[model samples]
Target: DQQVKQNSPSLSVQEGRISILNCDYTNSMFDYFLWYKKYPAEGPTFLISISSIKDKNEDGRFTVFLNKSAKHLSLHIVPSQPGDSAVYFCAAGEMNRDDKIIFGKGTRLHILP
Candidate 1:
């Protein structure tokens, strides 16, 4: 079974608005959660992350919220732009484990003009 899951395969948002992406995990052992953005042929780049102890973490235009009880997390982007259009992936891993990170299938986000 997949540990990390992104229910939505794609999403669309208008430019200058807010875009929200969601993810869920089945593993409670995961202590670190991260969001990555990927373009077509390029590898994924880290966007934001949150530790298990933190309920929320925010960057300039991005914010991540973790709900441990619900085994869920979400990423929010404000003032969505065309440049932000890309595939978003959610990943989770254990702090103690140095192994591979579990990644969701991905959610393609389209920023409409």
Candidate 2:
């Protein structure tokens, strides 16, 4: 069973528009969730995170919302820019498991100029 999945492998949006990416998880035991942005040939950088106890977290242009009931989460970026084009990964971890994180394949975001 896939513990985490990003159904859309890629997306394209024009600059200055809203870009939304989605993720789903099957493991309810995952208590910590994070979004990471990655560039070509580079490792992912932590974007935002939400503990199971919380529903939403935001940092600047990035926002993440978690729906525990649906075991789903999403990332939204407003005024998307060309620089925002990159791969985004949704990761889940169990705090009790010592923060061992599991990642979705990734969503490649292409911001059209």
List candidate 2 segments past 4 Å from native: none
| lDDT string, candidate 1, 1-113, tens digits | 98999999999999999999999999999999999999999999999999999999999999999999999999999989999999999999998888999999999999999
TM-score of each: 0.98, 0.96
Best by lDDT: 1
Angstrom error of the Cα, residue 7, model 1: value is 0.5
lDDT scores of the candidates, listed in order: 0.97, 0.94
Candidate 2 Cα lDDT to native: 0.94
Per-residue error (Å), model 2, residue 95: 1.6
Give the C-alpha miss distance for residue 68 in model 1, angstroms.
0.3
